[model samples]
Target: MTTTLECRGVTAGYLKERPCVRDVDLTLAAGEITCLLGPNGAGKTTLLETLAGLLPHTGGAIEVEGAPVRSGRPRDAVRAGMVLVPDDRALFRQLSTKQNLLLAVPERSRRSSALKQVLQYFPALEKRLSVDAGRLSGGEQQMLAIGRAILQRPSVLLIDELSMGLAPVIVTEILEVLRRLATAEGTSVLLVEQHVHLALGSADRAAVLVHGRIADRDSAAALRADPGRVERAYLGTDAA
Candidate 1:
């Protein structure tokens, strides 16, 4: 498989001395979805932010298709074909849905076709094009957030807490969209999720992070067969 995104020995956090994530190594292949699972405050978001260049890493390097991504330089990440959909769906609250999606496509000539493509993945959004993003339901807002990212044509997509505050049915629907994106667009996805079962179900692989370190990693099928092992890792009773 071709490597789309990779990080080696990354360490990052709010404070210099106490890194929230330390010595982390991760890789994503084209058209693959890897679920990053960990307990709350285990630095899942920190790791994703570091990888996306939203936060500077104190150590190690991130690369997209062999091009280095400079720390704390979001443009570098974006230029390298990496995009992050934060836990908070950062949509322009007052902007119409169409406007929000249009902002991601800088070329006016492509906006119409790009939006039409997005609507194919999320047909529901077509009806809400005139509606303000803030007025959409949680699920619709998430769809908009991801729709905006898709418009950017990201090769590597990092999503933080995609299932947060959403219903199970909605999460399932979104996961299906992600699968389609991976299959059709060949986008590499790194998903940070708290819902272990759902994440494992949709991902090709799973990595368990415990207290800022990777406790275990394996094929999602293997993890699903041995849920006790994953449970132990989350409980801090297992490492590696």
Candidate 2:
């Protein structure tokens, strides 16, 4: 199977001398959901940020659709069919929901297609089109962030923290849409999630990160059944 996204020996951090993500390699196949599971401060975001070209990398490369990606070119990533839906809410507070989406378009001519697809996944956005994005609730902001990324029609989508401080019902609603993209539309997803069970439920395969490196990579079903492995890693014990 051909991979939609890959990280090859990527090393990056805030300071060039100190690398938070060290020599990491990961591959996500087209049309599949691969979950990255790890404790907070385990360098998950660093790896995702480096791959997204948000942080400057001292070495190695990120491949999206088989093309090498360099730092400081978020647009290049978007153009190459890789989009990152960041953890932070990206809505423009002053803009109405409809205007916020129009702002997502790089060119005015692109507005129609972008708005059509984005609103397809998020019908609530259509209902609240005239309202300011900031006035909407937290769940709505998250939906906007994800919808904006998908508006680019990316082949690979990297989502950081899919379930962070949201209600269980909201998280479930979000995951359902993600599943459709991976299965129906053939869009691959790389999800970083704190909710282990939710990640397992949504992903076909999963990798657990420990101390900035991949500790385990296997079928999600297998991982879920092996409580000892997950528990040991989470509790600071070596894998039993």
Q: Give the candidate number with the greatest TM-score.
A: 1
Off by over 4 Å in 1: none
CA deviation > 4 Å runs, candidate 2: 107-110, 235-240
lDDT of 2 by residue, 85-188 (tens): 88876678989888877766778888888888877777877888898989988788888888877777789988999777789899888888888878877888
TM per candidate: 0.98, 0.92
Please give the RMSD to the true structure for each candidate, in Å. Answer: 0.9, 1.9
| Error in Å for residue 198 of model 2 | 1.0
lDDT of 2: 0.81
**Cα lDDT of all candidates, in order?**
0.93, 0.81
Worst 10 residues of 2 by lDDT: 231-240
How do the residues 1-240 of candidate 1 rate in per-residue lDDT, one tens digit apiece? 999988899899989899999898988899999999999999999998888888999998888999888999988899999999999988999999999999999998998899999999999999999999999999999999999999999999989999889999999999999999999989999999998999999999889998898888998889988889899999989544
- Candidate 2's error at 152, in angstroms? 0.9
